[model samples]
Target: MPSSDKTPFSRRALLAGAAGLAATSVGVASWQQLRQPKARVLQARCDSYDANLVGILLEGMAAFPAMLAKARGGHVVLKPNLVEVHPDRPINTDPRFIAAAAAAFLEVGAARVTVAEGAGHTRDAEFLLERTGLDELLRPMGVPFVDLNLDEAVDVRPPANLTRLGKLPVARTVMSADLLVSMPKLKTHHWAGVTLSMKNLFGTVPGHVFGWPKNPLHWAGIPNSITDLWSAIRPSFAIVDGIVGMEGDGPIMGTAVPMGVLLMGEDLPALDAQATRLMKLRPEGVEYLRQALELGATVSKHRIELLGDVITPRPFDVIESFHRLRA
Candidate 1:
């Protein structure tokens, strides 16, 4: 059922809105002058969620963005992995990280920051919010949450020949944001190899149009859809929650692995590539990322410049068992 309280964002409205993106001035200008040099990625060692997450976030981003200056004032949207809520399981992006992120963005200087997700599994986006405790978690941070599942849909022209999917339905808020952050929990998946910053984008589409579990995207082919979404949305930053990450079979229903490090980068493919390296999995081993590589849009080893901590490959605790499934 589509949301009764609000109307869906139509194609005409989104076109008008996207045209207005040029007027944002600060962020749009930044993009115009944006430089991607050797695709640098920064890492910070954080043993546990109890560590000074915000401090780690700050130190690694010392050279982050000029928008950090208060006068520039821009809007930022945080897209965290909130697929399903099981308090005992390390299933979603840790709320603490989200809180730390909200604080960090404000401290640096963002005029507006919102948390948005269109959880694919369940239909009750609100109940899911309460069950996940995300509502309470974000309430104190003064960051508002938008249920993208019901938020008006907008027509988006995806990259040609990227996927069988042509124009995808995207949330208007996602399209309008100045800086969109892809915040994902590092997890191994039965089908996709592993879920990282790029896969986290599944939540940005409205469930009302796509249906529960985002079936249309799955029908379009997971690898194809992934490449298409990453190409179109093009997130400004990626922050992977690797602290107490899931190892076995996941995004959900996986065992937790205590690999405590946060991965940060401006390039989505670089982050995913670095993520694949950290997990000791070959980047070419993941079908979607390899497909991304073919498009000349994703990161290759030569394109990445690692900063902060040394790259240490974590043990693939349960990959041996699930590895054969993808084969």
Candidate 2:
């Protein structure tokens, strides 16, 4: 049946308008030195809804001009958050962002680059790639697709306090990458509170080896588990997609907030702390960040230099359970 348009009061139009209105509300800036397309955290308030803007934003945040000169000869591995099979609205990392990022890596002269994610909370990586639009984006690029969940596993020693999980079988793809880029989405989690770059490394290990320890990690406490994971896998770079951050009931059935921001950094803690600050949530309050800080994971703000939007912080509608009550 050919549907007749009655009055154009559809949910798609409403949501699109809602998102566009939020994006267009911000003022545009000339490509100043501070807000140039080469900033470490390129946060342009893009008015246009075109997906091509993903490429522009990626070039900006990655500071491609500078990074490419240095990364010209190495293999690059992009690890995006395909933690679930939900739509891009609030579940996984945006496919446009990932494609744009992968393209940027190629532009910068990466000998070869590949996008990989070990689907855990979700069963199939290809399903996530399709749902997130990554399949179409990577089809023409000839990038290798690796299902981490189905990869050949190699046993490795667990870090201190994590031996209960025993020797874990890690995905060979993640283990062999010369340069690992952690591409994570900005969202609150029911259990982990916030799933940033550091926590996203969970997808690197095979479920067969690390799944059992999930309970021990949580039971022992969230921070320690995260610290253990960080120690296990060290990413060379990080890119946090905050273009549309998730707020309440996040990482799954959460509401999306139009943050319109992208962050990048060489140090995981430095970038994660900056992201935590932007969320207007106390970094010290986040158990994993706090524990990472305690473990000397580079939380010192003095060491980091800002390169993008001079954004004033805004309060995230943090869940009460996640919020810490100070004495």
Candidate 3:
């Protein structure tokens, strides 16, 4: 991974240089330094999940002042991962995390907050919402519940410079949202490597256009598809739920390890970088983050400020499918 203290490169120059390097070698470290991203990251450690909801909500809110500030009176859309069907599984975003965020938005005087998601693994966004306790939590708040699955479809063309991706399925409501707050669980993915803020957007893309009914977008490729989706609809604020993270074969089928941390960011790459550190993995070692860096995402720690509790994240007991780092 590139040192956080390394000299900063302008966006244009970084892309040009990275393009040349990627064409020649694309070493994990070189690819790790994305020029700069538009997102800012803040992290906090919640010692216990048993704290009062109001207090917890405030703490969570503090990490994302920019998001709340921007969403003062407008409609805010909250997207949580509902890729799988098990709520107790703890492999996806926790209901408490989503509920706390919703409550905070209201407490801060936001006009309306809508929690939305499109389930990729099941036709049960509604079920996932209920079982996960998000539906019950948001209903009384009088905020709307949106299933992106039921939303109208919009076609997305691949960017000219990119390859591997062809087209995508996008949700009309999500695309038009005034503010997007990402609530993703911290998990290791068999395909994408690490599933963080960028990978959370997978639920926003419709299956119809991206080959869900016929072809699963997973065929488009893991990290590549991840970056493409991020480029399409980057979230304004990202709040990662790492309370009980999944390790070793996740997004599903992993053992839950308690990390008790929540990460907030506007920059997806930086968030991923921090999450990588928490997982005891090198941010530059992850393929997608490096790819995002090359594509102009922010991976520089100097560009971000860390707020709240600071501690070293322990590496996962056993490395999984990721590339081994060069020490």
Best by TM-score: 1
Order candidates by TM-score, high to low: 1, 3, 2
Q: Point out the higher-scoring one by lDDT: 2 or 3.
A: 3
Clash numbers, per candidate: 1, 0, 4
- In order, the Cα lDDT scores of the candidates are 0.79, 0.69, 0.73
lDDT pick, better of 1 and 3: 1
- Give the per-residue lDDT of model 2 (tens digit) for 196-269: 89878767767655463334456656656566667677676888888878886767778887787777877677
Candidate 2: which pairs clash? none
1-68: candidate 3 lDDT, tens digit per residue: 56744758767888999898877675554444344644566677775555564566577566676777
TM-score of every candidate relative to the true structure: 0.84, 0.77, 0.82
Q: Where is model 2 poorest over a 10-residue stretch in terms of lDDT?
A: 30-39
Candidate 1 lDDT by residue in tens digits, 1-327:
567436677778878888787568766544433433467788888998878888888787665664254213788888898888777889988888987887778767778889888888877878877887778978887899988999899877766546566788889998898888889998888768889998988898899899999998888888778888888888888899998788777878889888888998888888988887787777667878877776665455656888888857875644565464332
The clash tally of candidate 3 reads 4
How far out, in Å, is residue 224 in model 3? 1.1
